[model samples]
Every structure is written in C-alpha cells, then in structure tokens.
Target chain A: MSMVGGRRSLVIPGEIIVEGNFRAGLNTYLENGKIYSTVMGLAEIRGRVVSVIPIKSYYIPKVGDIVIGIVTDNSPTYWQVDINSPYMAILQVSDALPRPIDPAKENIRKYFDVGDVLLAEIALFDKLRSPLLKANGRGQGKLKGGILVEVSPAKVPRLIGKRGSMINMLKKELGCQIIVGQNGRVWINSVNEKLIDLAVKAVKIVDEEAQTRGLTERVKKFILKGKEKIDLESA
Target chain B: MDEEIKLIDENGLRVDGRRFDELRPVRIEVGVLKNADGSALIVQGRTKILAAVYGPREIHPKHLSKPDRAVLRCRYHMAPFSVEDRKSPAPSRRETELSKVIREALEPAILLEKFPRTCIDVFVEVLEADGGTRCAGVTAASVALADAGIPMKDLVVGCAAGKVDGVVVVDLCDIEDKYGEVDVPVAYMPNKGLISLLQMDGILTMEEFEKALNLAIDGCKKIYEVQKAALKRKYDFTEKLKREADKSEE
Candidate 1:
C-alpha cells in the first residue's frame, strides 16, 4: 500500500490552496493515496495540523490582543518586551521621541516605566523570532485614562473580527477609544463614564456574537438601541 | 486609603448607581472557537474571559498518571496588555496561583472518574482584567467544557462580592476593586448548589465577609442562568443540524 508522505497531504485550517496538479474530483490522489478535499478548496499544511488554527497574518498588534509579555530590562537602544509566544517585541525610544525629553534622561521610564504596560505591535517578527514594535503609531502607547477588560488572549481575533470590523464598530458606537493589547487587555477610554460602560457592553456583544453572521450590524443595532435608551432617559 | 472616597452615599446609591447586591450586566457565548473541543467567552461587568477546554483525550508527555481519575490541567493567563498598565509577558506568580485556584474550583464540578486516566486541559486567557478574573475563568471554563460536551455534575459559575468602603457590593468593578477593602471570589456549581472554590483578599469584618459571601453566591446563581442560556444556544444549532440530517434520511 502506497502512503502519502509530504506536508501537503495534511490539511490545515484557515488556509486555501489553489492550482494543484491533482485530479479535479472531490477526492484527490496524492502520492497514490486518496485524500478528501474540502468543498471550499485545498490548502497546504504549512505546519503540523494542530487543533488550534495558526494565525495567517503577521501578528499585528490591534487595539486588543491579550498577549503575555515580560520586561527584558531597558536601554537607550530599546526596551525589549518578550511577548510570550515565539517573538520578542521591542518598544523603541524613538517611537516616543516626539514627547518631551530630558537631555540627561537615562531611564526610559520618563516615557515608559520599565515594567509599565508596553501596549505595542509586532513591527517586525523575523524567522529568528525577533519582533520589533512601534508604539508611536496612532492608538498605540501607554494605556491610560480608561478601564481595562481582560478576556482570553486566544479570543482576541474573534473580538477583532475580519478586517477590524468588530472593534471599529464598537469604537464608533460607544464613542470610546479602545486599545486592545495583543496580550488580551482591552483599554477603553472615554470622558463619558457611561461610554466606557457601553464600550464594555459592546465588547461583550462582539465576543458573544462573533460567530454569528452579520455581527457588525447586529452589534451596531444593539449599541444604537442601548444608546437611544440612554439618550431618551437623559432627554 | 482615602476614607472620604465613598462607594455608596447615604441616599442608598452606588458610584455606578447600582443598588447593593446588583451585578453588572452579564453576557455569555459558547462554542466560539472553531478548533477547540469547546469554547466560551463570558463578560461579567467589564471583565471578559475566554475559555477553551480540550479533551478527556490522551495525555501528553507520556507520563503523569492517576490510572483512574482524569488529569485536569488548567492554565490561567492574562494578556500582557489586559490591564491599564501593560502586564509582564511571563505568567506571574499571581496568575499561577489563580490558575491553581481555578483548577481546584473546577475539579469537583467535572466528572473526572468517567474519563479514567485521560487528561482534560482547560486553558483560560484573560484578555482583560477588571476584577474577579479567577472566578471569570472558572465560569468560562465550565461553560467551555459543557460546550465541548464533557459530562459534568453541573455548570460552575464564578462570582465575586466585596466590601467597598464599608458596604457589601456584588460584582465589583476595577475602581471598586482598587478602593474596596475586601474581595471575596467564589465558584459554585449552580445545579448541584455547592461552593467549590472560595478565596478572599484584603480585610473584611466577619459580618461584612459573610454578607459578601452570600451576595457572591447569589451572583453565582444569577450568572448560572446566563451560562445555561449560552449553552442552549450553542447546542441548538447542532440539534437543528441533526434534525435536518434525520429529515433528509427519511
């Protein structure tokens, strides 16, 4: 009996394979073994087909990513942050350059306390697992003036949704500045305390309704309805 | 400690305008993950917890055996950015302790003897840390397990009550947690009506603690309803699919 012996023989989730040399039926003969092709498409198994699907995109730090991290001490060069997974992310001083600086400043804490929250991004994560981050970008910096909500780090993607539709909707509806730490902490800031509550409510709505189709519309309706009630009561 | 900072005024109103013993809004969803055996995301007040339960399957590493009861491993981790201050990358000592507490809390609720020698790993990731995370973890994990179809004595609902200033408050928020004098987190199996995990931090007068504990239990009962609703919603889809299959066969 011939057996398929390549990584391509296995199936990986969240991947699509196009243009194959195999036959065009629902089942394909690969390396002389019959393999089932999903009605959706075919995809190569880039990694071991683990239970958890691998994140396809380069890890971009969104407003909320619950990432576990460690402080690797600070330096004039950069403050190294070990965002627990293979990559080590860096919070560079240059990103915080525009802020006021003391010429004699030695420690970066004036900008970011050594162990303070480094809400950052994966600016560059190479094959070597070295990740450089830039907090200088909009909506990236020390999480302040808001409440933090923590959920399962793994669920961050579901909360974010395809193309940031989920979080953006929450932000727009609640009128809150939501910073999602890749480490899974979501910082919601708003002068209106009720807005903070609304942001939290919207997040929960998104989390619960992630799998549901047309989630954005549903969440928007929920928020708008809730807001209408709040507005009516105030009026 | 700022003595003047009041959680509740003499008018019987709270900082958030909630009456005593009222929980913040709660929402729950089950089977949220496509890969895990079962998964749930729960939001209680502002705190959100996502839990994934994998198996009563084979044990990894080929060792660590009990020969009878299934080995239950629980890991409770906070996202590095789950707090106002970005948290450290490593699972801190506190998270480890919380993980153990959650594991112990869930142990009794799961029917371990049924899976004999297999292992069930419960992974809880706290994307945000408001307060009552351990309790949230327990609650989320129980729902995830049930979603995964693991047999259990009952669903566990984790809840917390605390003495803020001098009065008891159910489901304390972050500010209440920072200013509050005492916090009591409790995990209870709503179906079986038993407390499985209990932990307290900060100082509470015995009467205050008792009041908080009772309030926490009550909160657990309330949350249990949400858990049941979420589970029902999760399985209802599958039931529909099964019915469709039966209809097609007929």
Candidate 2:
C-alpha cells in the first residue's frame, strides 16, 4: 500500500478517505469496508487507523479534562457552569468546597455566585447527563486576577502542541501562569500588564494559524518580537 | 396581455440567458458569521441565503429532548423585503411547511445518534428570493451543518427543474417558475445516491416527470462540486503552505 499520509488532503463530510478495512479514528466513519470523513478536516490514514483532525469544532467535555468555566446560574444543589460546551456543567457544592454546606441553612450564592470564573476538572461525564465538575482539588478553585481568552475548541490541541511543548515555552518566556483549558479557554495570570496582553495576542495567533505547519516557531518569534518592543518602550 | 410575455426568448435561452439543463451561478462562503458556531452564505443567481448552525447542544423544554438521538430543528424564514413585495416577517404557512421539509431533507444525512439528547439547529434566512429559494435554502443549510463540524454521512444538495414552454430547464428563476407548467424540486445526497426531499408543483406527464427528476439530480451532482470547493476554500492558507513546501523542494 502507498503511504497515503504523504499526500494529506482536506476533506468535507461524507468524502471517502480510504477504500479498505481500517479502524475509524477521530472525525471519521466506517461504512461498507471504507472509511469516510464526517467533518471538514485534514484526513490522515496512518497504518490501520484513519482519522481527520477537525479544523473548528465546539467543546465537548470529557472526564479528567481541565476546563475553564463561568458560573451562569446556581442553586442549592449545584452551580450551572457554561464550559463552552453543549451540556451545562454541574459543580456540586460538595465537590466545590472543603466541607459540604447545608443548602437550606447556608446561602449557596455567596460561595460561588453568578459571573464568577473557576478552573475545574471534569469528575464525570457519561454522555447521558451534564458533566459533573470538581473544583476543590489543589490548584483548582476560583480564578482571580486573570484574563480569559477563548478560541475554537478544535485548536486546543495545537495550542498545547505535542507533549505540552508550546504551552511550556509560552510559560517560560512570559513568566506568567497560563492554564490552557481543554474547552478552548486560556487563563493568563501575570503581574505585568504588557505580558498579559502579549499572551492574549499569542493565543489568538495560535488559534488562527493552527492549520499550518511550524506554528509554534512563528508564535515564538511574534512573542519575542513583541516583548522587545514592550521592554524598549518601558525602559 | 400577460400571455404575450415570453419567458424564453426566440434564441432558445431563458430570461436570465441560461440554456436548458443549465444552472445559475452558485457562490458559497463558509464561516461568514463570527458568532454562530458554524455559518455559511449561499448565492445562486438572484437568490441569497444565510444559514447558521448552533448545536449539538442542549435541547430546550426538557420534554422535547430525545434519549436515543439528537433533534434536528430547522427554521426557514424570509425577510420582509426579500420578495418584490414586502412579505410578512412572521412565519407563514408556507414557511412553516418548508422548514419541516428542509429539516427532514437534511436529517437523513446527519448522524444524530452520536450526540444524543442535543439539538442541532439549522437556521436559513432568505435575504433575497428569486424562485428556487427553498432549494437554495436546503443547500445553504447543509453547508452550515457541515461547517458546525457535525458528523454526517454525506453533504446534501438541492436543485429544481421544471417544464417551461414545452421544454424542461434546470434551476428556474422567478419568471420561469410563475409561468411554467410544472416544477420539481429535489434534495439529493450524491455520496449515498439517495433522494431525501422531492416535491412537485403542478401537473406533468409520466415521461416528463422522470426526465425532470433525472435532470434535477444531475443538477445536484453539479452543485455538489461547488459545495465541496466552498468547504475546502475555507482553508486557503493550507493551500498556500503546501505551495511554499513545494518551492523549498525545488
């Protein structure tokens, strides 16, 4: 068999990518011993697996994924969080606080009110109900004094790069705490306003040019170039 | 007095100067709206349509949510000034019927079972109407659905053919449709080789109906090429990057 991966082609939904038996991977469907793409993306036929990396898609929460969410509405039982996904997230009071609060006696709104942002992990998502979140874990709770930048969820893997190389580089260069959410939300915490602004710009650039190769290098140059300008003006 | 008007000129060309079995100029723009999860704008001759998709998300009214599969909701609306006359902005009977028709037409191609209990909303707004707005709307909404990154078996396309002046023509404009003997609009999935939507307006002989249906499917096959190009064109940067890679090799 020829190496089909050498000639990567962009395909729309229902376009056949392979003509023989192969395990259908992400964004692909298996029918009649053939593999077809189910979304608009670049097709990759590697060995026994054929997959397509979608260029743009909405967030779908999965178990153990770190996500940034805003508190939309809350009740005594749980707080309704919009994690940029179709299903609303439920942050149970027990999972959110060190000790469970009495719903009837204590005012739950004071704990996590509407419009507050938090970084949490998906404790459970069974595809039958909304995702249940746990925020009481270490380094997981209310996020304060940070800017949230949102991008397409499909670009999240690119923003992170292979084995977190791109994210580690950003953190080292900017000297800031950057949390890359699986739901396409990025949180940047820094004391310097210029550094925060640069991080936001860098995240947007990654989201825009994610389809092309060598994106991490281009982003590095942009940040380095922007950092120099900021230092010069401030000095 | 109205009978004196000729939709087909003496040179055997349509009012829009198209020959029989010829389609209107089709232009599609993907990801046109920034806010919509996925959006596309389709232009087929004088007809202009904007389609936006918002889900695979939560379905409203807890009772409406299905456990086994997602619900495909469609809204086909026309702007007040889309037609020559100022049409009512409210959903008319025809618009309501067309919405269901378009929804059923697109439902077969989508794999709704993957996202159970969610709602995939396809909104098609007719900004300008010529004649084949329903067919144009179906094609636009299909692109928008794919643009949303929803899994589907195939992309659905729509086209219409009708008998006018004892001749069958593809993609009839308003003037031809109004004076034509019969109109047949068809929604087809080329990859699956299936017809999802078929509607007829007026009477036709058995032979003419078969010929018109085949011609409309042929028109759909042609439009499918344009739809695929529009989806791929959304990533022009990818093409440029490939070009640069080839240059480095030389």
How well is each residue in B1-250 modelled by candidate 1, as lDDT tens digits? 5667877888877788888878888899877898887899988777888999887665666478456577999999999878988899798999898889999998886667655546889999998888888888898998887666555556778998888767888888888888878888899876456899888889887888888889999999998878867765554433555677799999
Model 2's alpha-carbon lDDT is: 0.90
- lDDT score for residue B62 of model 2: 69
Q: What is the C-alpha lDDT of each candidate?
A: 0.68, 0.90
lDDT of candidate 1 at residue B143, scale 0 to 100: 80
Q: Which ten residues in a row have the lowest lDDT in candidate 2 chain B?
A: B235-244
RMSD of 1: 20.1
Alpha-carbon runs more than 4 Å astray in model 2: A1-3, B240-250
Best by TM-score: 2
Tens-digit lDDT string for candidate 2 (B136-233)? 99898999988889888899999999989888889999888988888999999998799999999988899999999999999999999999999888
Point out where model 1 deviates above 4 Å.
A1-235, B1-4, B237-250
Q: What i-RMS does each candidate reach, in Å?
A: 15.2, 1.3
The TM-score between candidate 1 and the true structure equals 0.50
